[model samples]
Target: MHTAEELLKLQPVVMKQLQMIFEKDRVGHAYIFEGGKGTGTEEMMLFFVQLLLCENPKNNVPCGTCRSCQRIKSGNHPNFHQVYPEGQFIKVDAIEKLLNEMSKTGLEAGRKIYVIHSAERLNVKSANTLLKFLEEPEGIVTAIFVTQNINAILPTIRSRCQHIKFREIQRDVMVKTLVDSGITQSMAATVSMMTSDLEEAFSLAKDDAFALSRKTVLKLVEATFKNVHEAMLVVHEDWLPLFKEREQVEMALDLLLFAFRDIVAVKANPEAMCTYPDLVPTWKDAALHTTFNKLSAQLQAILNARKQLQSNMNKTLMMEQLMLNLQEGKSFV
Candidate 1:
């Protein structure tokens, strides 16, 4: 039960939004929470849901002792429904059920809220059904649709809902929270620069999984220019970690991207840049030139592969191919 301020950084503007909703009581039935992926938009939506469903709710928070709050905390809240992707997208059938539920008088009255997380994944038929509910929503039905990209959503659905922008909760805010929660100052700073990505922040703070994976990435990279058995051992040690978190997967990809960038930098100026900057002296000028073009294509391939992940593709195969592409241009010395 972290404070929204701690979780979402308690930015003045976003706080003002809650105040505005409470003051005027004009909060729309449907709200579109939009922001960068991995920025805790889902967490923010959950917090808001808690506040609304809490029985003895104060200005912006729910009194945890209340019956409503207890049910929500216990995952037994009757009125509050959370719908999300089943596999890769929310189908039309799922949307229909919610629409039918909302069309009723009110399951429990005061406010019946539905959190449709990642609404962007909703298909065409599903979206149209949602639009109908938006057109003439029942008295107390409140729907919150979340997405990383609003432009990709149907314009009809977009127009009906109140769009709430969830921005990058400032790195300073995220860093301070992490430090308060027992993370060290140096590690907090490192994760923040990597992006206000929540998964990355968590991975950086909890070293057991992520640090091991990073060690694997480094070993594999260094092995191509040094030792093979050691690299494979490193990869096996943290292989399970990669399957655990999407942020870790993304971070691993970032490492590959960084390696590609290093190759580019080496090509552009051999002495100026290297993937593992400390290892610049170990690299030969001829070697950097040899893999230069291959690095460029690999970078593009990684980007293309990242996009492919958004679709209903096979994750294991996609990631395997991606890792293979990453190792393509370089030779094991």
Candidate 2:
């Protein structure tokens, strides 16, 4: 669990606005948090709820050890409710039941807080039912909606709530945060380029398949730089077997693209943070021998393979062509 102050640093603008709203005693009945994944929207929502329900608070910060805070921390707070999509969408039945619960008196005397996660997954019927509750609710009701895409929400629903947008985490900040969490600098740097979300980056770094993909892609690059025939052999023997699935192939291409990009970066600056820091010496030698034009064309070949993958092109042929293109103007000496 993150402290309110920590969340504030993650989302300064949203935190400041929430603080002002709390201080003015103008807490609204509905709020919609809009942001990409790993943007701290969920954390901000929890902190906001704690501020409203905390038994003791000072300067708009909830006393995390208070009775109310403890209950909320344990997720047993009677005034708090959460709704998530059951399948493809949030059904009307779920909304109807929740609305009924909200209508009744609570076990505690305070505001009733309900959060709907992935609000965009609400079906038309359920969305309409929730909109009615949003229009007129029982005493001290607060509704919060969390979504990655706000445009998918109903216009009427959007009009009823205060919408807060969460910004993407900075790359350097994400790298440092991941490093502090005990992730390797090379892996943290690599995943940072793979995704903007810290949660997703963590997931990737911990995944065995992702690690294998990085290793295989680096091996392919090494073989390509050494000899075109060896690169083709690796593709048939290693690459094709490991990256058979469509998504797997895409991830492999991403790793390959970054590997070439590292070579280019090394040519310009020796100290550049690369996805595969272990290969810096090898890439440095290749960078010293290769022309930028050849490197750019090699990059373009990988990109073209990505585009061809979308068209359901034969993966084997696509990769073979990319290898040939990458081998052009190449010299290890």
Candidate 3:
């Protein structure tokens, strides 16, 4: 439950714009919050709504202790409505029903706020219906459309709303956030690159499967240079069982690539960033044994394996071949 100020820290410009709107008493009825998944658009929307509904708001900040704020945080406020896609798309019926609800007067003496999650999920018919509602702005009604793909939304809908874009969190900020949350610096750096969502990165850091997969990948990397047979055995017995899904496999490959890059980084400059900083001794040893050419070849092999995986290649076979190539220190080129 992030306060409006905390969520605004991620998007200072958007917060400034919102403050200007609120201070001028010119808050619009329709707004399009364009951002990637986990980019805090939903948080910003909720915060804005709280400001609008809070009885004791000051400088566009909601009093978290207020009844309206509490209800909004718990998602039980009478004037606050949310619409989600039924399956693949937001059906027309959902929009029609929402419009019907919005037609009524406010039950809480504040703005009637409706949030549409994944607005692009609305089908053509539903989108057209929403367009009609946006065209005729009702009394004290605010509609927030949140979507990752702004281009997928209808042009007419886009034209009717005030657009606010949320940018991806910066890597340094994300790393610090994860580190502050008790994740190791090495894992924080790796997970930050894997996801733009701070919460998802934190969740991945705490996931047992992700932790095991990372350990197994690092172990396989060490075994590849020390004993190829041991590396192959680990992939078959440990890595494969834990990472059967395509997404998991890809993530493991990404970890392997990062490991090789770390070796190169160590060789180039001892002070360079290392993804596996906790395994600096191991990386330093690998750097001492392997030349830049060998490390580059290994990286190329892992990248090639990634492309093959996307082509629906057999997972076990791909891993085995990748392990062999990495052990052989040979270039796919």
Candidate 4:
């Protein structure tokens, strides 16, 4: 369980806003917490809920030992309600039931809070039904809509609530968290740049396959700058074998993109932080030989390959084309 103070590091602005709202005793009836995953939107939501439900809060922070805090922590809070997508969509039936519950008296005395996770998954019917409830909130109620993709949510629903955007967790914080968990600094630096999720970062940090993928990406980069033929050999001999799945191929492309980015960063400033800092000497040499325009083109090629890969393009062909693009600083596709 993360204390409000501990969560402050993850989202200072959001936390301060919530604390002010509580301090002024002006908590809104509805809100939309929007941000990417691992940005602490959910954690802030839980913290805010605890603030509202906790019978005894010190400095507007929930005491974790309190009954309300423990119940909320254990997912057994009576007044706290949560709605999730049943599968692919949050259908009308689930919204109807939740609305029905909201209409009645609360299970406890004070404010009743309902949080809808993956708000983008709400179908038209469910969205409209929820929109009606947002239109005229009854009793002491607060509705929080949480979504990674805010644009997917209905504009009408969005307009009804205060929107709080969560920033991506800082890289240094992520790196420290990973390093404290026993991940090597080099691997932590690379993994931290790849994702903001602590759980996913930890899993990848411990994964041998992920380590090998990083090595493969570096090898491909080296081969590309040396000789096109050699790069193609690396692809056929190594990349294709390791990144057989579409997701893995996409990850490989991301890694390749980062390697080029490191070179560009080195070109701009010799002391710049790098995803692959251990290869700074090689990156500096490549930087000395390349221009910004070439680096930009290489990055675009990698991005274009990623986009094409999502379109169900042939993975092997796409990678081959990408290698040629990176080698020549021009696209052949």
> Best-fitting candidate, measured by TM-score?
2
On residues 129-228, what C-alpha lDDT tens digit does candidate 4 reach at each position? 8886777777678999999978888887887889888988889888887887799988999999889887788899899999999999999999998899
Q: State each model's CA lDDT, in order.
A: 0.67, 0.88, 0.85, 0.88
lDDT of 2 at 164: 88
Give the C-alpha miss distance for residue 213 in model 4, angstroms. Answer: 0.8
For model 3, how does the per-residue alpha-carbon lDDT over 1-333 read when each residue is reduced to its tens digit?
Answer: 676656766777888888788879998989999989778888888888888888898877888889998898888988989999999999999999988877876466657889999898888899888886777766678889999988998887778888999989878778887887799898898788778898899999888878888899888887887777898898888888888888888898998899999899999999876777788888898789888988888999999999999999999888888888887888554
Q: What tens digits encode model 2's per-residue C-alpha lDDT throughout 62-84?
A: 98999899988899898888899
Model 1 stretches astray by more than 4 angstroms: 8-11, 104-106, 208-333
Model 3 spans with C-alpha error above 4 angstroms: 106-110, 227-230, 233-247, 310-320
| Candidate 3 whole-model C-alpha lDDT, 0 to 1 | 0.85
List pairs with backbone clashes in candidate 2: none
Task: Identify the runs in model 2 with alpha carbons over 4 angstroms from their true place.
Answer: 123-125, 268-271, 329-333
What lDDT does candidate 3 reach at residue 253? 91
Candidate 1 weakest ten by summed lDDT: 324-333
Stretches of candidate 4 above 4 Å error? Answer: 103-106, 123-138, 196-198, 223-236, 289-333
**Which scores better on lDDT, 2 or 3?**
2
Better of 2 and 3 by TM-score: 2
Q: How many clashing pairs per prediction, in order? A: 0, 0, 0, 0
- Model 1: how far residue 133 lies from native, Å: 1.6
